[model samples]
Target: MDRQFYIISYDIGDPKRLQRVHKFLKDYGKPVQKSVFECWLTERELESVVSWLADFIKRTEDRVRIYRLCRNCLQNVEFTGPVYFAEEPPEELIL
Candidate 1:
């Protein structure tokens, strides 16, 4: 399966809901900030992730965004200053 990159961000009105979302994202991606995550996922996984999160947010009060980045866009991403909070994937997985 091919995986595409996605930047997922959220703003939840309730503290409990925000925590829930945070925990969930941790299982699936790398957290770049308190409420932002960077994920590489297949189309099916992306849909599943969004569907799961939909259960936790209120339409009127919470906001969630998922930005799909093409290979070109991902390559063109720019960063500045210290990135202490940035998440790095493991260099190797040992089984």
Candidate 2:
């Protein structure tokens, strides 16, 4: 399966909701900043994430943005500080 890179950022008005959103995103991506994440996902995964967010957040008070990065664009990403990339879990084989 092919995965595309994305930047997901959000602003939540409530502290509880902010924590919930952050926790939920951690399952999918790496946290690049306090409210920003870097994710590599398939189309279905992305759609599911957005769908979940649509139903969870307040339409008027919370804001979520997803930015897709092409291979070329991802190559051009520049940052000065220490950066972390998400590591894939090791595959387990059961005998």
* Worst-scoring 10-residue span by lDDT in model 1: 83-92
How close to the true structure is residue 43 of candidate 2, measured as C-alpha lDDT? Answer: 85
How high is the CA lDDT of each candidate model?
0.82, 0.87
TM-score of 1: 0.83
lDDT against true structure, model 2: 0.87
Model 1 ranges off by over 4 Å: 83-95
Candidate 1 residues 8-44, lDDT tens each?
Answer: 9999999999999999888778888799998877788
Instruction: Let me know the TM-score candidate 2 reaches against the reference structure.
Output: 0.87
Best by TM-score: 2
In candidate 1, list every pair of residues with a backbone clash. Answer: none
lDDT of 2 by residue, 1-95 (tens): 56788899999999999999999999889998999998988888899899999999998999999999887886687879885565544434678
* Candidate 2 pairs with clashing backbones: none
Output the number of the lDDT-best candidate: 2
